[model samples]
Every structure is written in structure tokens, then in C-alpha cells.
Target: MKPGIRPAHRPVVFRDKAADLASPTRSTMTGDRTVTWEDGTTYPMADVEISSASHPFHTGTARVLDTVGRVERFERRYGRGEAR
Candidate 1:
């Protein structure tokens, strides 16, 4: 362990535009913009494309892909000789 070898960790705000959410966290990342938190504290702003607030899984909006149909089509075309 050495002194002054670690990068500066500062307060940052990660904003999710789609969900209109902002979370304050400490990170070593830097940004050119700033944003105010709910507590009226200003911090470096980092725009994120997606977050738990807007993610399908987190929001329970995720849909199962149509894999069953694709599998049925493949089996019909290839013919499951051993199974049939």
C-alpha cells in the first residue's frame, strides 16, 4: 500500500433519461456536466442509456422470446428421426 497512488473518488449523479431517474453515487469517473441531487447537492453528471429503473427485467416488462416456435419449425424441417 502506498500513499497518493489511488485515483480521486468523487460524488457523481447517474441519470436515466427514459426512466427520468437520478442516483447519486461515488465514482472515480469524471464528466463535463453537473447535476443537482434531490438533497440540493450538486455533483458531476453522467448520463446512462439504461438503468434498473428503465430496464425490462427490473421493471418486470421483459418478454420471453419466441424460441418454442423456432424449435418446432426446426424439428419439423429436420425431422427428429431418433425421437419419433
Candidate 2:
């Protein structure tokens, strides 16, 4: 690690509006918004569309999307190609 070469990381708050969650951590990312934590601590706020807290996989809301059916259909349409 080179001194003074790495981007500076400051206290930041990542807010997931959909999940209504806020997390405080250090980051090199910046944002135009500012948010105050419950403890009265203020930090630069970054808005995110999805995070682990709200993502389908993490929240246990993920669906298989009929992958098996799709695969069967594909194989039916394009017979198994001869191994080259």
C-alpha cells in the first residue's frame, strides 16, 4: 500500500430506501446527501437501490424462474449437438 496514493475513506451512511434501512460505515464513495444517525452522528449519505438486507436472494424471496423447463425447451428445439 502506498501512502497518500489510496483514496481517502470517510464515514458514510448507505441508505436503502426500499428496505428503509441505513448502515454507517467508512467508504471512499461520495454523495450529495447527508444523513444523521440515531445517535446524532452525521455522515455523507448514499442511496442504493438494493442491498443484502433487501435483495431477493438474501431476503429469501428468490425464485427459480422455471429454469428446468427452459432448459428442456431449449434441448427440444435444438437437439443435443453432436460432441465436436
Q: Write the per-residue lDDT of candidate 2 for residues 1-84, one digit (tens) a residue.
A: 778999998999999988999999999999998988889987899999999999999999998799889989999999877988
Model 1: what TM-score?
Answer: 0.81
Best by lDDT: 2
- What are the lDDT figures for the candidates, one per model? 0.91, 0.92
lDDT of 1 by residue, 10-60 (tens): 999889989998888899999999977778888999999999999999999
RMSD (CA, Å), each prediction:
2.8, 1.7
Please provide TM-scores, in order, for all candidate models, with all chains considered together: 0.81, 0.82
RMSD of 2: 1.7
Total backbone collisions for each predicted model: 0, 0
Clashing pairs in 1: none
Candidate 2 residues lying further than 4 Å off, grouped into runs, are none
